[model samples]
Target: MGDFKVLRLVTQGELSWEVETRYQQCYQLTRKTCKKIKDRVTVFQAPGGFLFDIFEIAEVKHWPDTDVSEFTSITEYVDKTLSGYFFDQELKSALKEKADFFTFGVDVFDVNNDKCFSHVELVATYDTKLGKVSCWTGKSYPTEDQKRDFINCPSLETHCQRLNGIRVLVLGCHDLNMFSPRSRASIAPGTSKEIVINQMQKLCDQFKPQVVLQHPHATDSANIWNAGWAGVRKFLPEVKTYSSAIHYFNTFGGEPRQPLTTVLNRTATRDVQNIVFTCFEDGGIDLV
Candidate 1:
């Protein structure tokens, strides 16, 4: 049997004439229903609901804020939560039959230093409709001279062709380094946001991706969202963007114990009107 979770919106102080009465009535009905249903029901109340007298009769669980740091933990939590709501065998069969999953790895290196400068190690794509999976890899330079060398490379055109029409683009750290004014200062003297913009434009012209995902640990700078937005806008003016960073309070902040995958899966299943872009600080899975 599937478990049922209820979310009730609660407000403080004396109930308003009509709205408060309606909410109270709804709460009463829910409470009565749960009493009859017993074990299968899980009741949750928002913070301000303490004033409600229903506390005496109904065992209400307070909704707690959540924060998660590790990727593997989040995935495990998500899978477990999903099991409570969806049958494991049925969900797996459905996903296999309906979802198109793709994985890509990105890395940026300082060839001169023989070290990886920045990178986003994992990017996974989720689509229920598309059947083909494709990947394109390339190295970017920090200076105009290095960029010119890239332009001269014969493989550039071929890679672009493979990337063309891809609906999503996942960027690693250092991919948006030029967008950071501080980082740009360390590159060739004339390396400006314009140069970065032009480079992005070239990629956009060829690939025309609809969404961009940025991983939190992939970059060297503190402002991942700003740099990512600036870079992606050059190629896709209205492209949807998302990041995996845990800094944003609304998206990825709370009690550290909350599973990151639960939030991502919830977002993916929401009935939004536009294309959805899911990102993670370390790793994530999406069902698009």
Candidate 2:
């Protein structure tokens, strides 16, 4: 019922898989990008400008990895390795420091069994009105995923929250097609009548979220993720769907990589909802 703008920072660079890199990503986002975030907010000040609703970072942007998991799940990785700073308390403080809204994802690992770990991408969203951090893990891993270790959470669970009087539905990477039969292919092989939950349609029909977001850390071509969005429209036709993602510096096609803002509809350039997709080179991943 409310109209809002989202400012997405799409960073382009060679990302590090070392677990410690996530902290640096956090610093770049919170400190270096602080001024741009604030100035961009003022430029989009309500009344005359698009009242920016969310400041989005590419999926796993502040986290280590390039659509790959170098570490294990929330508990195994963050609990033992990073310790006190793992929750990334700084990211939370940025909700109050940088902008009224901010979000980003981290790559984590999960035990597929006892042997190797499956990749689990985690996304965290913070809103001024909400006043707390909300985290959600990717619910699906497509059969097309080249990675051998993938855990498709078959529970039909997804993240749906209310921010600034607007209901927001968040999707991480392949969760864009969580209910697709193919998405469940490798996971639930011999199923009873193929348990299809129609999770998205159900959410749209029941919860009626106004906005849906897709956060992907893509190292592949734009066509790769665009194909997902093409499939995503059917399930989320009733609301506005935005994919805030990251790509390698040399990523192909023309998918906004330079720092610029665009309207949600992609028809015009606003200012803040006006998405500004910025990039950071190898070690200079910081926005500043």
Candidate 3:
């Protein structure tokens, strides 16, 4: 178990009904490829963090079609999505069978449609030593209710204690969008580099992570790419960073507009050897 290595899977592109099958195929292919290279994998684990999982459930419920002007009828979307039509039973079973740890992202909005808070949740981790799954939910941005719940939540307290030696942080594509000047407009207005830096500072202060993973899909220019890295380093100085260039494969005509290899290699200096780059073809850079 100690010999396991970390395998980070960075997915690109938006979710759609047309490419849903292909997306699942790609995920399975990636998992199989990783397994062939090395088994006994654990995702986010030290030395080797490769594990197999199935399905990503992202759904929004009770969202107003137009401006509702009230925060009423808000429901747990995950439960509804899981129970609704088109939900993949096989995939859900596979996830339950394969996933030992689960990470969730939460965004809270007010009646005015403004994002009041955003947080990441780590929950229900498997303990190989204990030979059972331990239940927990660790939240990054805790609300007053969450804080009250945490006080009475033994599992959450245990999870926090278990994270003492862990020092890795994972960022989603939306998180990476903050670094791209062109893409920043696609996100919330007034979202600037400073806002992103402040968020990173909050996370850094809470986690004190030694390694940061940045997963962005498409970067049009070298300047944009470097700016993304600079944004991360500015908040978390001297931290080792790992990023995936998965967008190269998703480009129109399945061809990159620019030579991704050239860009990655040029940026990979000895001084920044820790800032490793990877792609879908290569699976990922081995952390071990």
Instruction: List, residue by residue over 79-133, the lDDT tens digit for candidate 3.
Output: 2332342224543443334433322221222323233221123222434333333
Per-residue lDDT tens digits for candidate 2, residues 54-89, read 111222212112232322233234333333453355
lDDT for each of the candidates?
0.30, 0.43, 0.34
Give each model a TM-score. Answer: 0.34, 0.63, 0.45
- Top lDDT prediction, candidate number: 2
The C-alpha stretches of model 1 lying farther than 4 A from their native spots are 1-98, 104-133, 136-166, 178-197, 216-222, 241-288
Clashing pairs in 1: 66-254, 66-255, 67-255, 67-256, 173-218, 244-280, 244-281
Model 1 C-alpha lDDT versus the unseen true structure:
0.30
For model 3 the local lDDT of residue 21 reads: 45
Better of 2 and 3 by lDDT: 2
Best by TM-score: 2
lDDT at residue 18 of model 3 (Cα atoms)? 28
Candidate 3: stretches off by over 4 Å:
1-20, 39-164, 177-196, 219-223, 250-254, 263-288
Shift of residue 181 alpha carbon in model 1, Å: 6.7
